[model samples]
Target: MSFATPLYLCGPLREPRQMLADQQYSGHTSIHDDSMAEKLGFRAGPIEGPTHFSLFVPLLAEIWGQAWFERGCFSSHFQNMVVEGELVRAFVERPAPGTTRVRAWAEKADGTPVLEASASLGPDDGATLLDERMAKLRAPEKLVILSGLYVGMLGAEDEKVRMDAEQHMGDLYPFSLAQKLEGITENSPWYSDAASTPWGRAVIPLEMVSVLAEYTSKQAAFPVKQPVIGLFADQEIRMIDGPLFVGEDYLIRREIVALSESKRTESYWVRSRIYDASGETLKAEMLLNHATLKHSYADYEAEASA
Candidate 1:
């Protein structure tokens, strides 16, 4: 059946801090670190993206049953942070039979939608999809790998020295609340009514974390040979330590922790850690199968010229 089937999903998520604490104790440190979030300037531990995505799985199961995982494609952009005591909701819209579109968003008790997402699901046919096509186009040149090679080639010579947060904790991003709320949610009550809730305070969306990670990978090298690929395979939001207030300036720094070649897929895997202004690790990620800029249209042109 397509995602357009008559299926509806709705519910409220538990407290954000409790969830994050569980994730940290369980050794789930790939994303936000629950241990030192407050010290890092967060109101509380922030939730991981993957775990937040799962809020819809139950709804999918009701509609698609066991087949949801087999034929569904899910994608989400972290728009705003759902802090420690917020109530998040999930909804689905079915436009056509056998097709379903779902969305999730978190809000304060006053009903401000902080984070939002939309996903589509339908019958899976045995054919290559756009994502696969892109992968094929990216495979031959390996731009991501080449970028890593370039970094290694520099060997500390070109290392971009970053300011340590402990020594310089006050540096912030300076994004205003009004600006941060822009394009996030429509007529958000938090913005219009000055609503308060047990959810603490509004923070930056978790989706921004993903955006930062993608941007950092892009800036790690020069000449822009290959574009970084983002995979939302599995995300887990562990905590929402503190509020990332609007107009508050925050600093982010990334460091590559591990790089290795995959034996099975012959792809390169890169892991990076993101820290906030306090020098406390806010998020850590292991990006798999990122392509490097080894060859491009220029290489093809060179061959033609040769």
Candidate 2:
């Protein structure tokens, strides 16, 4: 809870780029676009939250070593939106000599908090940041944008997904792995040189792993009110038998695990399981909280009043 010093580790300040300015979803420009963000009340398009995950890799890796890539988990709750050109740095609390979990956070140079998180190495069984958040969730008194969604709902199909260096990730992402690497906050040969990594394959960057899982998310068809703006409220990514590799075949299956609401938004929690091409070997998992802004739905008021 406290982020005071002796900071176990701190990353260099970095200006993460806004690669999602051109991103589109639900047949409209997403909140990551400057125009859409302004219309939605944000000063400018904010860089995707996960883009900052790369900044913590070096710091975490230093603590857990190669095991960090194989079985580490990062669970986060977004605290503030960050636009391009803002300087941000990552920090990790120094853990007791044998503790598996530690507090982590990112902050802008001006002292505004960006996110608060928990980082841990496997085989960890303790509560993560999202675990704590999910535990305290109160069911919504009403549902509008996400009325049709419910817990335990499964994806429409088993999606076969893969990330290749040059393969564009579709409208939602609007970029390729190669393009992301060009401006990545951190870099390593393991991301590009197959022969250079201990796994003997090119591994996808931490942030790109988020992109890969979401690349074909639409195909899952967990129907909700359309054209509503949403943003990630909380997230957790766990590497099971990972570092997921580039140019490798993988399959993803999604399920709606929970739904809740706030004064201004309705949220649905989705858990995605990534597996080997055969769908038998579990590789990684991602749990995302997508919070849809109530005002963005054209009929939110009308439906509520009715």
Candidate 3:
């Protein structure tokens, strides 16, 4: 198991204009938008973290091909990096046979490394990648509970429509990869078309996942303003069985599988699982935490006077 002679991969062949266009159409509500990024103090709308993450595909495919899907694990942190107009590189280092180390960094065309990440890979060995021991080792006191209170009250019981992927398929939005890479770069050879790839050519950028999760969160019986405090901590994409095509309309069914409250921290956590029309879990384990505003004596007096 060794990578071909080249041993290095660069991805997303073309610059992704469609992503920017979609951001515009969606009212520029993306986390990467200049205004939002400005609130976070960034230069222009940052390219989406997930979109940046997706750049890993070319190298993973080159090194492990289809096997990467079956036995790959990725854990990333959304650190202080903004996505502006820049050329990023995906680098891989193979120190020994049966072992491949990978790292990615976003850079200017002039070659300054902006964002950095690394991952190690080996055989599965038929062992559970996500096991109880790993969970305990990760967070020993963490509690996993199932709560249906939110779902029982808010979730839609009846199916509204059977979404057709074809109906939604058409001209890729302005900000989509299809449009972004148009005059800037060529389409990724890794992606067959929006509807044909195992992971689906970057039809929907990764930034939208948080949006979807937020929308799904609001749909819950108890809608509240809460930021994403933490994720699964350790999450792996086992298999992307079906392609989520661009313009394809598909049913999204959600269920609140778990909820918990920490008396020590006075915070609440909720988790929901989403399934596509085919009953295959397209995405799962969305976690959200509650928050409260702090009030000073003057603030309390002002509120009291009001």
Best by TM-score: 2
lDDT of 2 by residue, 268-290 (tens): 99999999999999999999999
Name the weakest run of 10 consecutive residues (lDDT summed) in model 1. Answer: 164-173
Q: Which residue pairs clash within candidate 2?
A: none
Q: For residues 1-306, what per-residue lDDT tens digits would candidate 3 score against the true structure?
A: 964564445654324332542343222244345575455434666554445545665566577665554344333433344354566554544334466445444444556553454443434423232332233332213322221244333355322222122222112222323433343333354333544556554343222333333443433444322231122222222223332334443344444423333332212333434356555545332333332111211243343355
Which numbered prediction scores highest in lDDT against the true structure? 2
* Total backbone collisions for each predicted model: 52, 0, 16
lDDT of 2: 0.92
CA lDDT, candidate 3, residue 244: 33
> Model 1, 203-297: lDDT tens per residue?
33333333333433434442323322122322222112232332233444433322332221123333344334554634233232332222222
Misplaced by over 4 Å in model 1 are 1-9, 16-35, 100-108, 122-306
For all candidates in order, the CA lDDT equals 0.37, 0.92, 0.38
Query: What is the C-alpha RMSD, rounded to one decimal, of candidate 2?
Result: 2.5
The local distance difference test score of model 1 is 0.37
Between candidates 1 and 3, the one scoring higher on TM-score is 3
Candidate ordering by TM-score (highest first): 2, 3, 1
At residue 119, give the lDDT of candidate 3.
Answer: 42
